[model samples]
Target: MGYSVVKMKIGNSLEEDIRRIEAALEVVPSGKNLAVDANGRLDLETAIEYAKALEKYDLFWYEEAGDPLDFEIQAELAKHYKNPMATGENLFSMQDVRNLIRYGGMRKDIDYLQFDCALSYGLVEYLRTLKMLEEYGWSSRRCIPHGGHQMSLNIAAGLKLGGNESYPGIFEPFGGFADNIAVVDGYVGLPDIPGVGFETKAELMKVLRSVAE
Candidate 1:
């Protein structure tokens, strides 16, 4: 994989997570970025503790340290954590995202937003969300959708988002891009074909056709 950033899930235990982060730091080169996703497992206190402990490594972003809907926790955590933070993957409606922006205490300059269109209300709603972000003085470049699928990839390219997440070997035929495309130096070229390029992936096409029938 030619990924420039590698993200790992944390919140198992502070000691264990530190050990894992240290191990990852040893192998991951200095130029590349590393991120951690807690998936909303830690409480406010624990989240702050982890933030303090991991602050020295200068992670790419700390993701979902507390419950997604808990704006207060997110806001308070921002006060303690100085690095970039990411959330909103679990936020479905534009209203929810709006609330996050209004109350989540997210810094537009340094933090990133991970809002997956597929998981929420599809591309139409995602466009609205982008517009809302713009109204709040946030740039479209701060958005990085969460799904590792071609639909989100297309959104990333067409809308010029920060970047789209990739799950190369995790979800089989549904998780990656076209078979012909490859990631090079942390970047991937989109498929030239039409309609999200699902036809470019043989296995995914088979599944789609089967569902259609």
Candidate 2:
């Protein structure tokens, strides 16, 4: 319902997912400070079993426990599910999201939407598609990004949308090339520092200049 303070995954077993879900339920007070995302990596049956296992807990959203572009599979998965399912990772275009909606998942079980700016049609293009998501009865703000983790983080910091994924390890390694944001405590906040807030390898640059010279 609202932004969750803690998020998690099943770690790789139905039994584990069930136990974790129960523990999270005990802590999060029905519907706050907890959002669980599976990252789209389970079989259909496994997903269903996991979903059935945690009927009591109010999940903020169930992320892609399956295929990213397989709208057809997603369509069937979202059907008649009690908890809301979400998708949109490793997705490359607005068409991916549109197809997720057009197929059946979006309206049926796709409760939340996620996107990675690097993989999708870029942030600008994805932003345009955000408007389209609403036409299908979805919210752009609900779009918890997958890789735009930093961009989404900044947006979430402003309380703009649901929330953003904090792939600290993954994004930080890549952030050496550009700007990046981090999630502190439970909210996303940009660090104020020199040179986009990160140090650079002058030696690396000098090597390039030397090669050219």
Candidate 3:
């Protein structure tokens, strides 16, 4: 309930999605941002249409409206809309993310990068990707990483990234912060426990302890 940002899933029906988003906008107070994810499901034409329709909602970002690898589609959509664009969650390598920067029509002033460390061969490689961002003139602040795991949380803490994603109501035991921790005013304190801190979460700790022993 303390969340300042909300991301909704779309791409089901263009009209329905627009109405839904518009309805939400009516309830969301000013100063709060609402983002929407299409999960890379829309085709280019549909994506462009939705982009025009959704412009009025003033979304924080419209994410992955087409295939994750279709940088051209994303780029085209970007040209038609003023809202921020976000993608790269499915990209698993520095080169892939580099391509997004080079060809994805992402604007550093308003776009977001969502690279996931755990999905992309862990933090070692993710560090390289972060460095690549610097060469491309993108800041770590533009990157709100994709994975919702403790590993991403630790990395965000260590590297001072923009933020980490979370699925608080899904993927129990593995998709959220330490159980007792609350998202206070949209911020949560990281656990002091070492090495990704899974042990601090009761359900997650049960599995971790069982595997370690």
TM-score per prediction, in order, is 0.97, 0.70, 0.95
User: Per-residue lDDT for 1-213 in model 1, tens only?
Assistant: 788898999999999999999999887884138899999999999999999998988998999999999999999999999989999999988899999999999999999999996887878888899999999999999999998888889889999999999999878798888897889878998777778877888998899899999
Candidate 1 to native Cα RMSD, angstroms: 1.1
Which 10-residue span in candidate 3 carries the lowest summed lDDT?
Answer: 24-33
Alpha carbon lDDT of residue 204, candidate 2?
41
RMSD of candidate 3 to true structure, Å: 1.4
Better of 2 and 3 by lDDT: 3
Report the CA-based lDDT of candidate 1 relative to the real structure: 0.91
- Which residue pairs does candidate 2 place in steric collision? 4-34, 5-33, 40-64, 40-66
* C-alpha lDDT values of all predictions: 0.91, 0.61, 0.86
Pick the TM-score winner.
1
Which clashing pairs does model 1 show?
Answer: none
Q: Note the clash tally of each candidate.
A: 0, 4, 0
